[model samples]
Target chain A: MNNPGMTEVLFSLILVAIAIAISRFWKINVEKDIAIGSVRSFVQLVAVGYALNFIFDLESVWLILVTLLVMALVGAQAASSRVTKIKSPFVLILFSILFGSFVTIGIMAFLNIITFEARYIIPLGGMIIGNSMNASALSMNRITSDISSNRLTVETALSLGKSWRESSALYFRDAVTTGMISILNSMKTVGLVALPGAMTGMILAGADPLDAVLLQIIVMYMILMAVAVTSVVVVELTVRQLFTVHHQLK
Target chain B: MGSPSLVVSHVSKIVDDKKILEDISYTFYPKNIYTILGPSGSGKSSLLRLLNRLDESSSGEIIFDGQTIDSYVVCELRKKIGYLFQTPYLFEKTVKDNFLFADNTVSNSQMLELLAQVHLSQKMLESSVEKLSVGEKQRVAFARMLLTKPKILLLDEPTSALDPSITEAFEQFIQKITIKENLTTIIVTHSPEQAMRFDQTGILIADGKIAESSDIKSLLENPQSDAGKRYKARELS
Candidate 1:
């Protein structure tokens, strides 16, 4: 069978309709979410498709960089919104995601791991940016909540003349650990637990199993590095938000 | 009174346009155990917090050791004027970790000595703080704060966590440590009994101001101002 065209994709939406109908029958309350999500994803993916096609055809480094920068800005905005407490965290989140994506992808290109083609860079950059986004948000959330709750511990350390960094060290460590825990768990139980998304997708799309496996390995490592860098950046910025230069909790 | 160690000059703390502490001034002497007595919400804790620069005053100055507190580097100042919270928090892990956290250079003998000052056993060094009783945790926190050899100690209702017997002993230990180390000790307590037990200077804080400053017995038994007299009535009952 041929890969589903937009018409086939539209026909496939019957599955979502069926799910929505079942939710209605059971009064599961998530029918609104499912319906909105289906519509939003359709619109978003369609826009991304057009944008990527245009960027790829141009094949200009400036054009690709602009697109990646835009994506990083959006990713950062999304991640910062998820972090509940912090005064105006957009700049921090943007810098974290941008640094994580560009540095990793830039290294790969410089090392001749992947050519600087829009085809390769855009999708891979998107993956890195996406993973880093979640890690940054989750980590920031964890550390902020931890510090707010453990005010006495932090203030006690500060009262002992500990520097701000030294005072929040415990919370900082826990946040970074939490941010990277998902990737670490995946690394630990990847092939044994279940086939990962990338490998499965490649196999479904008729690629060689060994080739898919090799690509999956690279993808996992890239994600690991991106997540690690993002986690550090988020925690570094976040802990600063929680304490003043005078070593007092804010 | 011992030599003057800290001078609070016209200090007032206003938060949200309300007076937390209003035009309060006091001089603290080294080796003197000063007990700050006040009703709940009388800004007794607020006054102690201002001494260590934990919270800033809306208007006024605190002179620690003849210099304005703001002139000193904050971390260094805090080290010298250690503030032990009402409910002490120990860093998780061994009691040794708590001491080392305060001063990494503290030797085993020093740790034992410091713990002994707080009436803790030397065997408590390896004991995890999580496993310790609330009273034990407070003692350990007090010992840890002392590791840096602070010149002043701010205890915020310190004996609140301890049993009655432990509290009396701890109070005695505090009196001993204050004289032996010549530390400027400020304790904010709800108990008039504790204030009398310390027997240094008693300052009655009423409505964000010092209503009376006298010996604990006189302040409690023969209070001066109307506010002081009312506080005396409540305490006696």
Candidate 2:
């Protein structure tokens, strides 16, 4: 399969033009956003492509790790910006996403399911970190909202001699489930509803359909594990912050 | 009636640089019922919250059973000094679940006995808490609290939702249990008549300070402080 040239890349702008045209027709006032978003994504992806080419050629493990950390930091910052209830949620979010992604990817490398090469680790690690970041943010938001709104329920349990963990256990479970619901639904209708990005990309790049399907399955399971671990870790850390050592809700 | 079961010595609670309670000092005795009467936002509930360490005090200390409340394990302290909110929050499920929530080791027989004391029927245990009336929920909450065998009971407008008949009967039940179980009962109420019903020691607080602390008869009948007189005349809350 031949790599796409500049002509093919320029042809994709027609889709953006159509989107802008629809926005104009509807008077949605989003034509500027669509134009800016298209330009920004093009620039970002081109930069990333060049950076990845450099790192792949160098094949330095330290450089790869630093790149991953930078990605995780960016993801954490993006996630934390969405959360308003808690103070300084960045450290906890970063820890959760890093731990979840590292553990899942490390296990796959250990099992030789994926090698520790730059090509495999960078892309796979990107997927793990990206998924884990969303899970962490979703769970953190869910637990904080749940606890604040249900002060009576939590304090009632506390006043009845239950510890902080016991008082907020229901909200903890709910937050974890909320974080996981998207991936769970994706798993249910992965192939039937729409082709997932990994598989579609592989198939589009001339890989065999069966091989693409197998890779997509692995990606699905990897995302599930990463999301589960990240969400649980985030909820655990968040709930601890909601209460004091004296078993009182903060 | 006995040595002090709980003591609030020079306690104050300041929130966001605003004083909610200030230099509050009081001694609570065992087997005695104390009515905490004040207008809305008078810090009556805040004072009770301090006793159980629900909210930290800005200054002063709370002593329960001869030890500072902080000295004991916090969960243990809360268990001993049980608090019931203005509207009883029953955990979703059957009535028995709430009992088990308080003290899982409580036997069915013990639960039945406590229910009888609170005038709840045996069949009510299997019923969902949502089906029970507000008065019944209060009793369930009260009985569940007793399962912990608290030395002190803090009731925050426990009967505000109940009708007159249930309020009178519940007040009697609280008084009877205070004597029978030797629990030091501190009830926060808005109505002066409710304080009169308790017919015991009364603490009248206004603007975060205790305006009157005396027998129930003198507090409502012949209040000495201006705050108490204003409270009596329904001019201040």
Candidate 3:
């Protein structure tokens, strides 16, 4: 029999080689980061493979809860690092992801469209958490930069008897608009330019073509709600800290 | 009715283990243009910011119009005191939008009149702020600041980045606005010649403290100390 796994490994190696060559030609210092990230990804995926096998077998609700808790903590850490100067970024991340992902997951589960089993729960949770993390990071970074750069304008608004929220409305609008654009664009091109991961995974798992398409539709809808809600809410909360109690931007 | 236009009492600021200002006490009356003349890093800008409460004083108090600055809301205080930076910080929008900012109250006629006062035409309003020359941007910024109808104006080297002709135009505009509006103005500048133009009262700061406070021409003519002599040399040079 042909070693198909060997083909996958060889393909990955070639991709790495091409990445290195491009980096060298462009004088990019991403070589060390790429090497370390690849190694870490390998180790993490292997470890998670074993852990997930055990988790799937147990079929306990508590186990699923712990897994989601771990995901939240990791997502919070990632989001916080991107918007560093603000204190309590973890709180904003936690609130955003928990509200966004859980709401999406809850609605889908309640509809009985996707099974409440480990097989569906873990993957869906991962997708929701990952997308929400990206949205939160983008919105937070944009809002922070916006507030700092448009400081004079913000102060001008404040002087005009506007509240902090009113003063920062323009920035809040810009940041959330920027964060949602990617999701919106992907939505615009869905099923035309790209077959997203959920759809591809469902298809490879021997699911019917129509069934896979339906699941992908649900997942896309959930992602839209999660990304939009998470980005807007997180930015609103995080920007409150940029101002003093006296309504002044420090 | 008896309240002074602005009052700063015993204000001090310490940052990074360095004292920027210490026990600064002063009263500024209405309809007068005051110039803060100081060598670089002498905390003149810090003191000016203290009037509007932009920079917090570590100790002591600032009172404006018989009320403690701490008592007035920060936003309200800032609205009453307009601040203009050395470099024109125009937004990435049309000149008209930059003037209006988030303020919907400023009407088209008011903006046009303001532009005309600064020698800019209505045709320039629709142009992007980034496309304007530095002097034009400064004029736009000044017009924008005045739109709020601030009772006091704080200008930090308004013409520092301008060419001689533009600086002369800016100075003339300054004279017109201060006289017309009867606005209490505090200007921070390094040039003695420029300071003499609108400086009805002068305060010289050196080594993080006020070295002299007198009439602008008097301060220029009679050198009081080594610091004053240094400023005089700059003027002569």
| lDDT pick, better of 1 and 3 | 1
The digit string of per-residue lDDT tens for model 1 on B57-170 reads: 888999998899999999899999999999989987899998999999989998988788788888999998889999999999999998777999999999999999889989
lDDT of 2 by residue, A85-130 (tens): 9999999999999989888988898999888888988998899888
**lDDT (CA) for every model shown?**
0.89, 0.91, 0.81
Model 3, DockQ value?
0.27
Quality of candidate 1 docking, DockQ = 0.78
Candidate 2 C-alpha lDDT tens digits along B1-237: 668999899999999999999999999998899999888898999898888988899899899999999899999889899999988889979999999999999899988888888878998988999899988998898888888879999999888888887778888999998988888999998878888888899999999999889999899989999998988888986
Interface RMSD of each: 0.9, 0.6, 3.2
User: What are the chain A TM-scores of the candidates, in order?
Assistant: 0.94, 0.98, 0.86
How well does candidate 2 score on lDDT at residue B130?
88
Best by TM-score: 2
Which pairs clash inside model 2? none
When summed lDDT is taken over every stretch of 10 residues in candidate 2 chain B, the lowest stretch is B161-170
Clashing pairs in 3: none
Question: Model 2 misses residue B150 by how many Å?
Answer: 0.4
Regions of candidate 1 where Cα sits further than 4 Å from its true position: B1-3, B235-237
Off by over 4 Å in 3: A1-60, A81-88, A110-117, A146-170, B162-173, B235-237
Interface RMSD of 1: 0.9
For every prediction, compared with the true complex, DockQ reads 0.78, 0.85, 0.27
| Model 2 lDDT at residue B56 | 91
